[model samples]
Target: MYINTVSHYLPSEVIGNEYFTNINNLSHEWIVERTGISERRKASAEENTSTMAIKAVESLLESIPYSKNEIDLIIGATYTPYDTIVTLAHAVQHQLQIPDIPVVSISSACSSLLNAIEIVEGYFALGKASKALVVVSDHNTAYYNEMDTVSGHLWGDGASALLISKERQTDSDMHIKKIITGGAATSGKAIEAVVLRPNDRGVIMPFGRDVFQNACVYMPKVSQQVLHACGLSIDDLDYLIPHQANHRISLNVINTLGIPVEKLISNIQYLGNTGCAGCAIALSENKEKFKKGENIVITVFGGGYSYGAMLITI
Candidate 1:
């Protein structure tokens, strides 16, 4: 599988650390020191996960120029879907007027993008799809309380779309080398540590310590496993893209892997943690910065106690 184009859409509303500081009674410097997020985007009232994803897909289609009839598969990844009855993938298909293509939705939290990529690759391998559109979006503001100092302040709303094809479209296109995904259920109790309950008072309550500890361990472990499977090492990686859950979590994973901080591609400072859209958006935003044939590793850990990694060649 090859990536033909990548694009993203972010809402107009920008929320800064100052907004959180005033609401949470904490200094802006304190928030920055802990999360390294200065600002994040929030979707407007009219925007939802599906709409954001459709906008991203439109941008991608503009670049790739693939007709609706050419697309064989559509995969949407999101944990914050606007409606459970109609999947985000189906909504995107409806908006794009994509004809009768199989639409699948994934709810793997932060790891959903990578997981979606793997699913598309499987379809390609089976000769089931020649062209695939993978879209991911999340509206964290919809679930979290604005006044909550911890989880609420850490999320942003964004969507990303990637055009993947069985054959490379151009010499500049990037190849999907290896994608590995897995997680341990031993930490199943940690599920409640980072949860967004419907009836609960608009708060995405998270146990800070538990999440931090698990992220620090699982992220590096899965990253190493994927790298080894691809017969690559940390030194061979030209760029490392980890799920932008928190600044500290990213730093810990880099430190544990002993990879240089400069090699890690991080957008948390501006985009915050956009859940499933984090890694995909970061990849799209940094696409031009990558050189051909360079190795890029994406490692992610999410709320299901889920973790995985993918190795790509640019």
Candidate 2:
């Protein structure tokens, strides 16, 4: 599968670290030192996961001359959705006015984008679809609690869209070389380490030490698996894009892999942790920086003790 275009959308409202510092009674420098996030965008009342997804898809469609009818598959990835019954993929299809296409929603937390890519790759390999729209939209602000400083302050709202096709359509297209995903429930207690409850006071709670430790181990493991599957080593990677869950996690993964820090592509300092949209948003934002024939390795770990990696050629 080839990526024809990638587009991302961020809301107008920017929430700085000072907002969290004042609300949580923590020092601004402390938050930055721990998470390396300075600011993040929060969706306005009018924007939800679906709306932000549509905006991204529209932006991607506008850039490419492909007709909406050409898109036969629509995949939506998000853990934070306003409505559970009406999937974000269906909402995007409704907005785009596409008929009878398969609209699938994936909820694999931070690894959602990589999972979606694997699904689209299967569809294309099976001759089931020619054009696919993969969108990841998350609005964590809707469920965030001011009192919960652990995971609450790390989240932001945004969406990213990718247009994937069976064949390369442009000279700038990126090819998906390999995608590998796996999950390990270390223990029963690990299952509840990261969760967003269903109650009215739904707030994301993360066991910091468990998450950090697991991320440090699983991210590099999965990345090496994908790299080996593609017959490439860490030194062969032109860029390393890991899920922007935490700056510490990113640094740990880089150190574990022994990859140069300059080759790592990170925008978490400005965008915060956007759940499923983080890696895709980073990829879209840095699309122009990649040179032809260069290789990129993207690794991600999220809730459910899930982790995955993908190798792409630019």
Candidate 3:
């Protein structure tokens, strides 16, 4: 599979650490030192996951020569959903007004983007779809509790859209070399680490230590496995775009992988954690920096104890 184009949408509302200090009494220095997050974006009252996704797609269509009718598969990924009944996939299809195509929505926490791409790979392998659109977004502020000091300040809203083709659509298309995903729900403290119960606190990380520990271990491990599968190594990678969950975790993964610090790409410092959209947003934001024949890795570890990694070549 090849990525024809990518685009992202970030909400206009910016929530700085000072806002958290005033509301939750958490110091700016403490938040930045712990999570490396000085600020995050929050959606306005009129915006939600689907709305941001639609905007991302619109933005992508504006910059690319792709037509809405050319898309045969639409996959939407998001854990924080506005309406489960309607789903993000259905909403996008309705917005595009395309009929009789397979539309699917999936949520695997922060690993949702990779999982959606894996689904696209399956569809292409089975000859079910040629051109696919993968949309990932998270409306964390919609269900987040500003009073919860554990993860209140970490929530952000953003969305990304990717146009993927079974075959290369253009000379500059990025090739999807490999993709792998797995679950750790049965692992230690995996299920209890992060929780998002609508009836309870919108999003909470009661056992953040456990989440951090596993993420540090699995992200690099899966990254190495995917690279090895592609017959490449860490030194061959031009960029490492791990899940933008934490700056410390990213540093730990690079240290474990023995990659140069400059190869790491991160957006959490300003966007905070956009859930599934973080890595995609970072890719879109930094697309210009990547050159032809460069290799990039995207590894993710999400709240549901889900994890994944993909190797792409520009």
Candidate 4:
């Protein structure tokens, strides 16, 4: 499977550390070091999970000329959706004027997207569908405990959409070379960055330090596993796109693996923690940075202590 196209939508309102200084007890220096985020785009009042996804679909459609009938599947991967069961994918289909296509809504916290990745990969492997869509959206800004300080500075809101299809032919220019995914079972009590209250409950709360520690271990190990499965090591990849968890987790993973910083493509400095959108956004932005036929490893890690990686050759 290959990602045919990708589009990202970030709100116009950007919040810096100074906003948190007045709202909560925090500093830019600390946020920049710990989370690797200098600024983040917060969704405007008009934007929600579904609307954000719609914007991405609009952008994606502009690149690929396709009607809804061509889309056999629409998968929404998000921890924060419009509703518990309803998702952004359905809204996108509606906004795009397509009906009757099967839409699957899935959640794996920060790891929600890789789960969707697996789903798309499998659909192609089984020859079940030709063209598919994976959309992710997070209105996490609304969930943050501005008064609680735990998740205020770390969370941001954004959306990303991707179009993927089965390799029409070997020479078709879109093919998925390999994918390796895994998860680690950390102490359940140690997890954070979860919805304390359901979609209708309390609010979004994240245990920053706890999430960081698990990521340090979870990210590198899975990346190595993905590399090993493909019979290639980290040294072979031209770029590494790890989950945009935080500044500390991303650097620590690279450091632990002994990978050069130049071999990685990171946008956390601009977009903040976009959760599942990180991989799609990073891959899209770094397309020009890679040499043709160069290999790239994209890693996705999330709050449930879930971690996974994908290795692909462009």
Candidate 5:
């Protein structure tokens, strides 16, 4: 179970913190200090979750055009789907012209893609599916509250897709060294960390304190466990990518763990928070940073109040 190819699509609209000052009492400095967000990209009217999924899958297909028929499963991991009845998997399958493959949608928030990785790991191990496509996308601004300054400045619109494939003879061309991939919930935690109620027009309600605590405790611990499972240590990883929820959270985790700042792929400064697509987009956005044979650790705490971590040898 290895990631053979990857692609991502970001929205066209860019909104800076200044736009919020007029609507709320928050200033650019306050937002950056609290959540470490300067700007976030919002989806335009032309873009939907389906359209964004197609954009990423199109790029993914180009790199493996002849292998389309080999794919048997398509997983669309998104918290923001355009339609309830029609799964988002159909959008990628239809655009890519692969009608026979099973298409399904899953929503686990930021950890959805990592959970997808675990799903494919079993699919390959159990001889259920040879090849799978995992795509994570969301359009939060359409439903996000403008006044909820903490969360509003943190989320962005983006979609990322990855092709998981198996090697014919265990060649070095592709590799996936799965270290720990999933973790149980921390005790006494709420079922939902963040929620929005449209009926009352409430802000993107989130227990930021709880989210921050979860990331700090679970993320690094899982990262270490994954590395140990891989017969490696934290210092051995060349790149570490976490859910770009906030710069402060990322920095706090790595710094507290004493992992070098250069070894981390901190993208919260630019991408804001992309929910399930955040870590995937970071990997896609920084693929070049990974040298062949370099180890990487990806950890995420998603909206399910669920968390997952993985160690892969690139």
Candidate 6:
């Protein structure tokens, strides 16, 4: 599989760390020292997961040379949904008006993006589709409690869209080398570490220490697994994009893998944790910087004890 084009949408409203200090009584210095996030974007009242997803798709369509009718599959991934029934996938399909293709919506917390891509890979392997559209969006603020000091400041709203093809269609296409994903819900404090329950005070992290420990372990472990699956090494990677959940997690993964800190790509500092859209948004942000023959790896870990990694070559 090859990535033809990618795009992202970030809201205009910016929430600085001081905003949290006022609402949650968490000092700016303390928040920065812990998460390294200075500010995060907040979606407007009219904006939601599906709307941001549509904007991202519109941006993608503006750049692609082909018609929208060529897209055969549509998949939406998000844990924070505006409506569980209609789904982000249905909203995107309704906006794009692409008829009669397999449309599905899935959630596995932050790993949903890679899981959705893996589904596209399955479709390609079965010869059921050659071109597909994957949209990932998370309206974290919509379901987060700004007053609860635990995880209220860790979220922001954003979305990303990826256009993938079974065959390379352009000179700039990035090759998908390997993808690996798994669930650790049975192990470690995976189930209760981080959670988002409806009418249960939005998002909360009662066991942040456990979530941190698990992320530090799995993000690097999965990164190495996917790299080895492609017969590549950390030395071959031009860049490593870990889940944008925390700066410390990204640092830990790179240090564990012997990857240089300069090779790390992250946006949590400015955009906060955009849930499953984080890695995809980073890829879209840095799409033009990758050189030919360079390799990039995106590893992720989400709240539901879900983790995944993908190796891509430019």
lDDT score for residue 305 of model 6: 93
Clashing pairs in 1: 293-314
RMSD after CA superposition, every candidate: 1.4, 1.3, 0.8, 2.3, 2.2, 0.8
Please write out the lDDT profile of model 1 over residues 18-58, one tens digit for every residue. 89877788677888899988999999999998899989988
Over the stretch 1-314, how does candidate 5's per-residue lDDT look in tens digits? Answer: 67877889898888888888888878888988887788888889989888888898887777763477788889888777787677788778877777776677877767888887777777778888888898888777766777776676677788888888765323333466774555445533535567655465533545778778877877888888888887888778787887788788888889877888888887676667877888888888887667778988888876547787887786
Work out how many backbone clashes candidate 1 has.
1
Residues 195-284, candidate 2: write the lDDT tens digits. 877675665555778888888888899888888898888888889999998898899999999988998899889988888999999999
Per-residue CA lDDT of candidate 6, range 131-226, in tens?
A: 999999999999998987888889999999999999999998999989999999986889988899997878889999899999999999999899
What TM value does model 5 have?
0.93
| Candidate 5 ranges with C-alpha deviation above 4 Å | 168-174, 183-188, 196-203
Q: Give the Å shift of residue 238 in candidate 6.
A: 1.0
lDDT of 4 by residue, 1-314 (tens): 77777778888998888888777768888778677889888898878888888888787888774565688888898776766655677787777776776688787777787788788877877887778889988888766666656666777788888887775433323345766665565545345455545645444554566667777877788788877887888778677888886767777888999988887688788888887887787776766666667887777767556777777777
The residue pairs that clash in candidate 5, if any, are: none
What is the C-alpha local distance difference test score of candidate 4?
0.75
Please tell me which model should have the higher TM-score, number 5 or number 6.
6
Question: Per-residue error at 260 for model 1, in Å?
Answer: 1.2
CA lDDT of 218 in candidate 3? 93
| Every candidate's lDDT | 0.86, 0.88, 0.94, 0.75, 0.77, 0.93
Quote each prediction's TM-score. 0.96, 0.97, 0.99, 0.91, 0.93, 0.99
lDDT of 5 at 252: 82
Clash pairs of candidate 4? 35-247, 193-206, 197-202
Q: What's model 3's TM-score? A: 0.99
For residue 20, model 3's alpha carbon misses the true position, in angstroms, by: 0.9
Ranked by lDDT, the better of candidates 3 and 4 is 3
Error of 6 at 25 (Å): 1.9
lDDT ranking, high to low: 3, 6, 2, 1, 5, 4
